[model samples]
Target: MGQLSRPIPLLLLFGVLVLAGCGALGPGFFADRSPRERVLLLDTPFYAQEDYQCGPAALAMLLAWNDEALSLPALSDQVYSPSLEGSLQPAMVAAARRHGYLVYPLDQPAALFAELAAGHPVLVLQNLGFSRLPRWHYAVVIGHDLARNRIFLHSGRQQAMEISARLFERTWARGGHWGVVVLPPDRLPATAGETPFLAAAAGLEQAGQWSAALLAYQAALERWPGSFGARVGLGNARYALADYELAQRAFRQALLLQPANGAVLNNLALALAAAGQRQEALVVIRQALELDGIWRQELLRTRQKIIADQP
Candidate 1:
């Protein structure tokens, strides 16, 4: 990790300068909230950072609050860069995934507040200095006092740092307002939309966490019952877990929502074939092939499998 006493690099300074010239990060969604609005604070554990270890420390706090309780040093191994003297963003996402948590970026500034309201701590990047000399830092936002126009964070050596919302936004904007939350398989982010949340759960399915991915997809479907992507994910997870009947049901439901979706039709065919309905599977696979685009090869493969397996 980089030394705390080191001066900000020229490149970072230039980035900060550019952000400064762009003006405020737009009138964020929460700007109109009354000063007397409700305050929210999550009971998250605090871990003071040891120099450039804020990334690990902030991640540990978030994990602990989520009941993971991983050690900071252990996380450092996953996210820290010995060469760059800090953690990279992809490594941070990977580390969260390794721990069986689905991580999604909070794109809107207001989403951070929404997550806090839902009792989830958010790890955010900040530039804590002037445009001429930026000090990059990672901190966990655990609470907000709209009445005071302040945000509470576990930052640096301080356990509970109260910063003005304006300053916080300025620094956060420099980092592209980057924030992320690690969610358990069964829980969906309070502020997360259908597309991003489905994407996150799909990542779990891709990693072969069939059961976890199933739960994530179930949550997504609960939030968005008509989401074709969620249904496809549910079907894929069920298929991976060998629940062919449910897999067929999920794929069929997705087809009902998007009748011409070739991928869904292909998955339905595979589920039918797996469940010993070879003739029916061939019919479905043919339909998939009829509507196929990028999934044409996959539909053809499913059709071949059904034909090969016919008694």
Candidate 2:
């Protein structure tokens, strides 16, 4: 009997498991019928994937388009998973940051299309086989023709493979519709909201890319003036770079927005201490300690540092 004709209990069980796993996603795909038709075929370079090297290939394509010259083999060294015979998601994000690009996962189909419309190619994951027998593949979406219901991708050996939107959605749904976009430090993603953008910048800071994180924080401030989080992030990045005067200015601005925040006061005090204003730093640190919060230990440390700096 053919595979389809056989009563495969395993396949049925896998289908149930997949559905249950995706239950929290609520639903798949957009409900609107008339999505805006757009054709923004960005001049993004393409690289044919070799065996289980689609991750590196797709990442190379994105980095090349962002004006970084990197070979697939070099990227493979950074992201390739030897045991799994493929690349992991965290490795992909790390590789992008390593090449000085800001990478963020897209959560919505509309956001993916929005990035394409804004001349950014999106990398996505797809499962080409059944739920039980998965064939995971990575592809780059460069453009789409919504009127014809067709999407274009740089997949496998095809530089411009055209597939129906419905088919694309089905395959993408099997992989949880995972999508990501890479942006330069000064640039922002098309679907970038204030909160998520700030989070991405903070992630850069945590990754120890102080210069890139500083640029991202400055960009955030430009887009959202008086943003408390952006101000705090800017202060943190500047402090890391030893720009104490700028850090103090940014922390002071953040304090204005969120007065009584011990964390902000603590950071500001540290910046003041670093700038040689030991008396003022001691006063600020004392104020922070008086506030009942989780930053008491940090405030105490800053007080000790300020006292130590005094002659």
Root-mean-square deviation (CA) per prediction: 10.4, 12.7
Candidate 1 residue spans exceeding 4 A from truth? 1-30, 33-42, 129-134, 304-311
Error of 1 at 166 (Å): 2.3
Give one digit per residue, the lDDT tens place, for model 1 in 45-96: 8888886888888888878887886778889988888787777776777677
lDDT of 2 at 88: 75
RMSD of 1: 10.4
**Which candidate tops lDDT?**
2
Give me the overall lDDT of model 1.
Answer: 0.73
User: How high is each candidate's TM-score?
Assistant: 0.82, 0.85
